[model samples]
Target chain A: MPIIQINLVEGRDDKVVSECVREVARTVSRTLDAPLASVRVMVNVIKPQFFAVGDVTKAESAAQKDKS
Target chain B: MPIIQINLVEGRDDKVVSECVREVARTVSRTLDAPLASVRVMVNVIKPQFFAVGDVTKAESAAQKDKS
Candidate 1:
């Protein structure tokens, strides 16, 4: 079984999320030649405060932007 | 930066989920000799209905169990 896990910053529309899950499973199955029914896709939508880049969290960066 | 993604079936306490994320980040940082500050951990808690095994969803299996 092939498991695909995706991490995304929260705030996407539900429709986009649904399409993403479906498309990713389809693409992975096709690429790996695995059965579509056996593919599992798990998505994690993280809050901005929980995601960071270069030691600055997305929430922090947003706040800094507001100050400038 | 090393990113670690974990997929877990839902129904865990919030405390446990927090601890899991923290411990996993620490372990990955230690094992990979990476800076803890530079490591990122993402946890995906999937709904039972969306997770499957052998083409049977967890929700479906549970329903079957209730029927028996």
Candidate 2:
């Protein structure tokens, strides 16, 4: 069984997050020739400060006014 | 830009991994009404030992003979 976890900045709607998980799991199952049931998808929405992009913490948005 | 990283057990076909990345990115962009260019997807494949599910390291597959 293959478990997939997606880590991204917080602020996503439930619908979008759920769909992304299902799609990723489906694609992997089909491409790897594994049973769909064998794949699992997990979503981890972290504070922007938890992630950094070129020395800038993406999680900063969680505490800032910017929503990007 | 939002970067999406998918961490999973290794041994998946290239086609599947690529598709999963694109699909997750697309879904998040559409559902969140964010620019497609702002969403980034990154995949980190561990050696199984880095991950544990119910006392079993999923990455153990990287060293074991059984492919789960």
Most lDDT-accurate candidate: 1
Model 2 misplaced stretches (Cα beyond 4 Å) = A59-68, B1-68
Residues B1-68 of candidate 2 have per-residue lDDT tens digits of: 55565666666667787876777677767755779988887777766566776776765544465654
Local accuracy by lDDT, each model:
0.78, 0.69
Name the runs in model 1 displaced over 4 angstroms: B4-68
Docking class of 2: acceptable
Question: How does each model score on TM-score?
Answer: 0.53, 0.56
> What does candidate 1's lDDT look like per residue over A35-63, in tens digits?
99999998878866555543445566788
- Name the lDDT value of residue B57 in candidate 2: 75
TM-score of 1: 0.53
Top TM-score prediction, candidate number: 2
lDDT of 1 by residue, B1-68 (tens): 89866677777775566566667777777888888889876666789899999999888998999999
**TM-scores of chain B, in order:** 0.84, 0.75
DockQ of 2: 0.35
